[model samples]
Target: MSVDKLDMQSPDLVYQNIEKLAESFPNCVTESDTGKAIDFDLLRQELSHAVVEGNKERYRLEWPGKKEAIVTANLPTTKTLRPLLKESVDFDNTENIYIEGDNLEVLKLLQESYLGKIKMIYIDPPYNTGKDFVYKDNFAKDTQEELFESGQKDEYNQRLIVNPETSGRYHSNWLNMMYPRLKLARNLLSANGIVVISIDEKEVHNLRKLCDEIYGEKNFAGEIIWKNSSKNDQDYISTQHEYLVCYVKDKSINKGNWIEKKEGLDEIYKAFDSFKKKHGEDWEAIHQEALAWYKQFSESNPIFSSKHYSWLDEKGVYFPDNISGPNHGQYVYDVIHPITKEVCKAPSSGWRYPESTLKQRIKEKLVHFGKDHSTVPNNKTYLKNTEFQSLTSIRYKDGRVASKNLAKLFGENLFTNPKDPDLLCELFKSFELKENDIILDFFSGSGTTAEAVMKLNFETDSICRFILVQLPEDLNETLRTASGGAKATITRSIQYLKKFNKPTTIAELGKQRIKLCSANYTKKNKPTIGFRVYRLDDSNMQNVHYKPQEYAQANLDLFSDNVKSDRTADDLLAQVMLAWGLPLSLKIERLEITGKEVFRVAQNSLYACFDKGLDETFAKEIAKDKPLRVVFRDNGFKDDTAKVNVKQLLKQLSPETEMKVI
Candidate 1:
């Protein structure tokens, strides 16, 4: 029996696209010099109802390097994520993940494992304000070599280069950086998933057009205007707002509305509880007390509007809604006054509900009646029942509050302009996500997205998890060019990192933020506060593993082993998991069977062993568990006979098991 060797590379998008086209139009597919390819002329004819033409003028957003961006997205990467147990909080059990690498490479590597699994994605990428840097993705070299040359592998020089306005490709640079990342990110979203991108005026228009191309114009959800600043320091207009562009993966599957639970409800409920205790069903007295409570808040406060629902009863505080129907009229019916025992005056339009429903409401004490029959009865709309509101298109919040809170959390202004966790918490609540839904943020700066998800989970008693990816941007290098307050802030951040002997990188600061957020939660209110840390690096496999045919027979003994010398069992396990399309967050358990170490992931889902000197005893012992898939090192067998014996043993025992080697 011959064992298959796993090709440790990301899923090939070009090949996947070819398969997708073949499924729809098999006649339009043809074989090329390289592989199966699409015949564009035939495909166009298949799509067109009339005659197909060539090079027709059409509206589209284009720029220099756009083709390169598309190529960058389709190209597969062999880079693998190595688990860092030393930097991780809860390496084995945590479902959350933190990755340090160029997000483009990370997104490519995650394509298979997380395909159509992510529920939501929120990114706060650089807005291209001419001062901030944009990623310089090199399409010529291997990803590992490119990262090292650009300073992203060992340092952070090649990845981030400032795009000044004086440059010829100012806008093109930003678009090129964002295009490939967004393209890869779209493949990870579920059918009903959504993605929100934050941008300023500088790139908002371009961003919308770019998104329109990537995510079809029909799937455009809406744009949210966040008015967060009040500065008046512009030349022509004082810009005080940034935008949040939202898009759904497939608009057909997203049928539910986004609603936000109104804030200050807790305070109102607490006050009502106190009044009910003191007055004991005396709604009039409670109404007077509530009126006095409303005086404490200014009109600008959101809770001040709650005073309209002042009427109280045994049921709770309620607003007396109009019984009249909307527009012209509804069901015309007469409601009787319970006190006067007479027919109440009907509304000019009609009753909002039908007679049967109105009678049921009157019986349930959900309708309010006047003392005399001359007035129309009102609907008792309880505050407790109307606690949710539709999310608005515009939001107003002071941006400085987030900076202040971050300062308080770290005892210094270590980060500049961090996002408000509270705001994101409210925004996430609007999604009404289900348990274990994942939220991803590739440009996770300051780790605010992680903190926001943690806070949301705690408040809602949810199990939603987050995956954050960030480059390890060196703060010391940034400090060299920073001036005034920016330089001082970097200095303070460097000093803070030195106290813990941590590297001075933005990723280190983000990890600390997540750790602090986790620590702040009490043990009783646990919400999966820990996360597994992974750093993107070269694949665990050696060059010979990928191209064994290129090597001559003379070097067969010299290149017998395919794995890197420095790689550990855990590293091999990680690469195997990726190759098998298993999530890195799955539960990992180490087992020792027949004196050979083995790793079982997510129970019987997969099993891997890289230990040497494997024999039939080890294979029989592992196969007894009946794993669905298993992998072993190619050079682990004691001899050719032992390898043959092990394969026969697995086939005899676990006949359904799919076995592979690397």
Candidate 2:
């Protein structure tokens, strides 16, 4: 299809049309006096019976004999008694990090302390290729399974399922997986920060819409096209460009400009010799060549003179108007040259100083005249008077190639892709970097951001710290064949430091090993002192054994490659919550008093901790506490239990609390 036709064929527009159509259809039931649909009066009547007398306002009615009960529990009064061990890996002393695990969990763990503090975030998430390990979506609450099996159709409907291409909800599945994560990421960006998502064309459109919704459409920045590959083998044509969608938290608050300084005029003078050597020193030709070369150099360097005019009277080539405005109201008249003895007319405007300053100019012998005594005189301004060059976006061929040269210095493809440290260094130069400015990059990748910041600090003698996050995904096979696998990526990155000749050792990198740190809330009553490790769950076990050794040996064949038997899901979840800053003293109780066994947590407020079977009676008891927060395990709830009524129970008891399932 032509580009114009493709531009008009947007999936988003089509989706909007479908949504409008759906909304226009009317309900098949009658309307109530409140103008709301009245199809659920029977269910409401049943729910009314669940209320406990005076607490009727706090309870929600579910069904006739299946009425749920409501009660209020006191919040936990326990206090934190001990200091927590620092779980965070300290990379402040270095510029690298290699984390091993799921990025989603890591991101959640960082939300508490790092919220709205990250300066830059770069993510190369799985592209959702059918073969890629897509995160399994878990939306069903713990009670769902129970309700389903109890001859209840609604509860069975909430079972967690993998999204398949033929499901007709392919895009919806991807969107659901990404929505919460992106929302969390937006909260972690600094007000003046930006996030860059690297994506292929397949999901670029979806990513853009997702980012617009989370980061605000007004904060949308332009997309940057990166040439990721030289060869492409597709059904139709080669696709070589990947997009880097940039979004700022608040565009108005972020004031960023290209970091480049103009080249000094002296460099232009030095270049004259090279130009003469290339294109012989024919005065006019040499001047032309030099001027052309300087123009290109100045465009990038921002230091070369814009106007190349020599002093009118043999004062030499210099930029016009070097002087500033008159200091006082006194009008400084132009001085007469000592040699020409004529009133020297300042370039167009007049001398920078008033007439009184003319005496100083003559005394300093700073005035000059034209070859003809009668012609208008001029001032002598040497080329040495050049200060720092101005800033500009124009890039010179030389500067543009510096990054490539730097990349080559570290070895061929040593790093999959490395950014120009100079680019970041230049950025630092433009800002007033305080000694304590903490820079962060969750997508640390090859650690280029750290290296760039280090280089800037070295040059300016400023002390700045950096936080880098990089998931240790196994290196691609291509990378392994070329430079060995995981070890090579790390080795090449650390070795690049030799370019600066600083005392960086492989041992130092190892010593400064990055540890997985969960958010503060990942812990339980007593926070996990060490890293809370986790592995994906699998169900291939041949048999269950109580002993660790027996389980490992007998079930070896049944264990999936990524499965873990050392820790339970609850153990890992607790650790993750502790690291995420969840407070201790939160109550946890397993109750068998409802339709399905349920776990209840009550402290300052109640939280349903039902990660397993949720009994109706247990849920009723949980509702009694008037929980302020509740989360359920996707596979815990029964098939026969009513899922909709679970929501109704919460609404009747504690209307202001939040309820979510994982």
Query: Where is model 1 poorest over a 10-residue stretch in terms of lDDT?
Result: 547-556
TM-score of each: 0.81, 0.43
lDDT per residue as tens, model 2, 113-204: 46676666656554554333234333233545543432222311212233345433455555555565566677677788767676678778
Please state the error at residue 325 of candidate 2 in Å: 9.9
**RMSD (Å) per prediction:** 12.2, 19.5
Candidate 1, superposed: residue stretches over 4 Å from native: 1-56, 141-158, 271-298, 302-310, 325-378, 525-528, 544-559
For every model shown, the clashing-pair count is 3, 76
- Give the top-scoring candidate (TM-score): 1
- To one decimal, what is the Cα RMSD in angstroms of model 1 from the true structure? 12.2
Give the poorly placed runs of model 2, Cα more than 4 Å off: 1-97, 122-182, 191-213, 217-260, 263-306, 309-318, 322-335, 345-354, 357-412, 431-433, 476-662
Candidate 1 per-residue lDDT over residues 1-662, each given as its tens digit? 99999999999998888889889999876544343568898899898899888667579986677889999988777678899999998788899999998899899888878999999999999998887778988868776876765555444334777777756578888899999999999999999999999999999988999999999999999998887889999999999988989999999998649997777678777887898899987767887887777556425554346446466788877778887888566777667789888889998888888899989999999898765999888999898898988887777778989999889889889987777888888888898875999999999989999989888877777888899999998886677657788888889999999999999989999999998877665358454478999999877777734322222112323435678889999987877777677899999999998888999999989988889899998988988999988877778888889988988898999999877766
Tell me model 1's lDDT, rounded to 2 decimals.
0.83
- Whole-model Cα lDDT of every candidate shown, in order: 0.83, 0.47
